[model samples]
Target: MVDRTNADHDVLLTKEAEEQTKNNGLKKKMYKIAFVVQRYGLEINGGAEFLCRDVAEHLSKYCDIDVITTCAIDYVTWKNEYEAGETRINGVSVKRFPVDFPRETKRFDKCSEKVLCKTHSIDEEMEWMKLQGPYSTKLFKFIEDSKDQYDFFFFFTYLYCTTFFGLPLVADKAILVPAAHDEPPIYLSIFNDIFHKPKAIMYNTKEEKDFVIQKFRNGDIPHDVAGSGVSLSEKMESNNSHSLTRKESFITYMGRIDESKGCGELFDFFQRYKKENHSPIKLIMLGKTVMKIPTHQDIKYLGFVSEEEKYNTLQNCDVLIMPSKYESLSIVLLEAWLCKKPVLVNGQCEVLKGQCIRSNAGLWYENYEEFSECLNLLLADEHLRDQLGNEGRKFVDKHYSWETIERKYLDLIERV
Candidate 1:
């Protein structure tokens, strides 16, 4: 069994103690955090990007935070005068630098390719370094040029882009949040082990925490597990559209339109069910499609909605179906819960399965039949849907809110 008592108390006390320290001025230091990621605000379409945006927004309130990334243009155009330099968004600063791509031995343009398990490796990481090294060099130069201007440096993602770039510059004072390590060629484990400096490491789930601890820490990971949950209530009142009615007859999936996300599977299931039963239930997909895939008849693709539209979609949907083959505890799932919508998750996500079972917020299924049965059950039973959604909302309120989770983040920062 896991040691829950000591761990839990340490978490609570650490959070409290940090607040106490800040109040006492024992830890009253304003931080300047340089968040180094591969892509900046324009390319924040995925889970990591979503989390990075949240962290940037929240941390900016406390620190002098600037996001350092590359211009999504090729070497020739990216080298243009207008593309190079720092710009401010809200209260945060962004430095976009020129990125050079290696010879096209493969199909990736490097200008607009998604980083995947296939893309993060010793060979690929070195290539990533070759491509992104100039940008990182400029980032480092920007930091070094303004040495006393910032106090902290935080990097997003583990094996590739940010880890190599941000770790060396900040050294011991750096923070690394390894989002999820599930997608792999197995060799990434070695890079993650060796390259991960003992500066504070943050994870999104207990599963990820344990995985890091087991592999890197010899069953003793000195890290804090943070829920990738966000602070939405502040914006909720202003952005709230309408309360969803029980009469709504639809299911939705939100995320990338990629094969690994199980979009094809969802479409196939919906097609079979629609043909067999003539169910009037609609299936809507939200988010941009990176690859060309076959479309479904009744599936409505609402590609890349705004934040307001995203919440609106979630608010109206009866059920959220997450069919990703590999997920590191989705922000979309948490958002679905926060919106009081029930989720139908793939059974492969053990962390999500634990969350569903423990909170009674949703259900899990292994195959098409089970998925179909769950969908049918949710469609037929209004009472069960309400109960599940209510449970999910409660769980999110207690555990996943930024007010609660931010304290833990602050405590970790104080420790370093």
Candidate 2:
């Protein structure tokens, strides 16, 4: 016997040690990430909320992700609309808390005018921030109590109470996805610490990053333009063209139908364009409307269609119109791109304009004349639309595919 007993003992011990090491490595790699947002639910169609949900769900495969949010469904009042408690939506754990008080629109509006429109003192600005409600103590309490549990925290949409208050408490561990735009809120000096204090920041586009840096000088902070993923149902790829099927040319508007989103201007422009041009193209409105859709035979309002339907409609349409002057990154633009469709954007939005220039995917309009010209041009030239759509798809493929985004996210988590 060539020392069989000793040989067996050595082999067993080696295997045990290797197993322990592997288990330890697995534990270390399994990051616990927390996503804090103001509102979340299936019914919520706002871009920020949707981005939060999609990212949380997708990242669940790589880490232990939990969503901390308020029970408010609507951003207007921040009323307790969703069930307040822990639940699992799309396989990710979510903890929802109640708002301390619902928002008084009139009071908040007055505060907004002073702080954003005119000027205000620090204390007054802070008061305005607090009045932008969903001031949930329990959420802060949870973060306070569970500081050691998560490796990192992501606060989405910088304009909310959850972000303003929660971000500072976890400043060392926070990664801000600001979803910011060049609005009056960005001018608030109160947000100086909010932008500069975070450990690292992520943005939706290069223009968003540039805008934030220009405003806050948070440029020194480690940040990148890690845009949201571009995903569409398979049905959209082979989408039916309305020109071939219905013999009608149409332009589709996606996103919230509200005055702030530049919907009123779009309607005015379209009404004038329709009356003057005598084109067969109809204007189709998608998503929830806050204002009454102008009653016209050529205008069609389809309330709150699912992403599948929206993308399907997107692929078939002559052009996609994003009229919003303020945008961080138009997910709708990316959606239109992925559907191999041309987009028409507000030239006033640098983010949108940047995307159009970078991708060469569509046109932008400054005035009704420009809008009418671009709309008519896109409708008239099928070959140009195809070329633009192809370029747009290439842009989306190069940057926003799931593989590219997931890798970027993992890199961020790894850095954290």
Candidate 3:
């Protein structure tokens, strides 16, 4: 068993003393692990990237952790944003390699349209993958050269070039965190190779694990559904007089404001409900908006907010809305539950729907009618809202606590 509790003591032993202890067959092995991802930084709010950083930091307590990533920050164009070199962030070592070239959006979109909508050959799909890239030869070389240096290499997000190409180089020791959802790229022939090559897999949710198994027929691989952890903010515990005032009942959405996230559909449904019912309820959104937000009296967009402000707002809101149609695991959904708030999510997403059914902590909507009806039901009954919210908090505490998540990860690592 790994001496997780005595990591400090183990590190204090001198090199010669450690060698002597090892010669005596009494030394405990300290695992060295590497996390490979496309983009990594404090400001990168993308779901898979954030999860990689969080898990790396948490595991650093018991293992030697290093993050291998690209210098790009912008996912859309894969443009280099950070300096291409080694650095330390939050005590984790990060080594970044520059992307060979920034992506051309128009070309990539055209390629995607052809590959996704129309039948294409494997070569055409490979070309599309190149277009959809933060292709870094240097990163690949580093992984190939240093394969024996770490006990295992964890590749995050199956869609990225980093995992697509890098995993095969270190397949004997690669553990994939696919972070997959129902998407077009997943059905491609290349991904079969990526999925089958990993030594083991860490899935974010059971829905994702089932989906991948059914799609790739790779159920034989060792795997675990180890979802990311959520930590409660201390600021959320303290009362802030200047925080959002809940004079009228409101539903809040917190995430990247993009059309693909089902935000446009959410806006339409909310606006129609307001007009038809003449309800005093409002819709509040907090995130970086990538699309044009409709201007209206009932719709309010407060741009990117601080963690304290987010939790405080979540505490005040009647319902937290998660409109994203594709999610392996919604961290914000977990965050809302941590705040003891009920959530409203799109039912089309199997992961979100499964989470709701399992937790019994939120409501889902398939269409505008269902959306409006569920919203009205949650708004009209304060007792029902509180009941759901309390259930959600219990669910989060039971499954998503940091201790539970950390233990799951360490166990999986040891088993693999």
Candidate 4:
């Protein structure tokens, strides 16, 4: 029985100290853990990048944390640190590595900037980038260099970051928090048919947990199911609504606007709804727009709002319209619940189905017609939305916060 309360704050503890702490009432000493994020840091600003930053910071309160990542440069001028050498970031140590880039062309940086900034597709330009990009070779070398330093390793997304870096690092313990199982091939390539299977053992959500268990027979790979959580108290405080007009409000969608995320379906359905009924509710999408289609006028796209703006939008919206074709579990859904907002999720998602059934947080629709119908139903009734929203908040309070999720990781560390 390793004690979990007295986690080490600094200075890596010896094996004897660890044993003594475990034997005593103190929590196990904080292990020196390293995180591999290819991005700059918490301020890098994508959903996965932001989540990684937060999780690393929160975990650091209970463990000795460091981030081994790439440098924030146009080309590959990375070293063993951020500015020059190792630097501390909000109590977490950061070390950067140089990636392998090809023979210089000044045009490469401009093209890279265009692609990343979303100003130009640069899809064609990447052929040159492929020759020049240092991400792959540098990543492998960085992993090989730092394998012996950390006790545990974590990655925000698997296929892109972890599978490449973590696969080589033979750490005593490895954890991955895959936001959603994006595609079958990506995971299949990593862990074969049973990619997420080992992790199901550690997570609590039976829907995701058991589905993974049932999928794979390989019993050797050790993994644990992990989910991210937020402090609901802040959310609860913002749940009350002053704009509670019985008038049907606009349907809102918040997240990235890529096609795979069901953006096309959402737009088509919303357009059809507008054509059929003079619905008071308009469909609103709050995120970066990847497409250039001009048909979605009523479907307003507020590109990349700040945290305050996002919460404000969630608070004001009557119902959230989600059309994800596939999702492991969506953090956006949890955010909606925390705002006391009802969600309309696609029924195809196993995780969303379970969340809807378990919490009554919202409804699920299979097709565009059904999706339109469900939105209409919510529009027609305020009480239903209220009931669902309240229930959803209660469910979130009970299950989906960082406080609860962190304990699972702590337990796994102790047991492993």
Cα lDDT, all candidates: 0.66, 0.83, 0.86, 0.63
Ordered from best to worst TM-score, the candidate numbers read: 3, 2, 1, 4
- Regions of model 1 farther than 4 Å from truth: 1-28, 73-82, 102-136, 140-149, 218-221, 231-248
Residue 162, candidate 1: Cα error in Å is 2.8
Whichever of 1 and 3 has more lDDT, that candidate is 3
Clashes of 3: 0
Q: Pick the candidate with the highest lDDT.
A: 3
Q: lDDT: which is higher, 3 or 4?
A: 3
lDDT of 4 by residue, 87-180 (tens): 7776678776655443355665655455444444335433433533335555556666766656666655543433444544543445655454
- On the 0 to 100 scale, the lDDT of residue 313 in model 4 is 74
- lDDT per residue as tens, model 2, 1-416: 11222331121224543454355342224567899999888898668888999888766666668899999988888889888899989778899998888999999899998998775799989889999867899898888777777778999989998999898887888999999998877778888888988888889999999888998887888877878888775656434433332355688898899999999999999999988987888888889988899899899887887666776688678899999989888888888898789999999999999999999999999999999889888888999999999999999989997656666777766665
| TM agreement with the true structure for every prediction | 0.80, 0.90, 0.92, 0.75
lDDT, candidate 2, residue 188? 82
What lDDT does model 1 reach? 0.66
Q: Which ranking of candidates, highest lDDT first? A: 3, 2, 1, 4
Supply candidate 2's per-residue lDDT for 38: 92
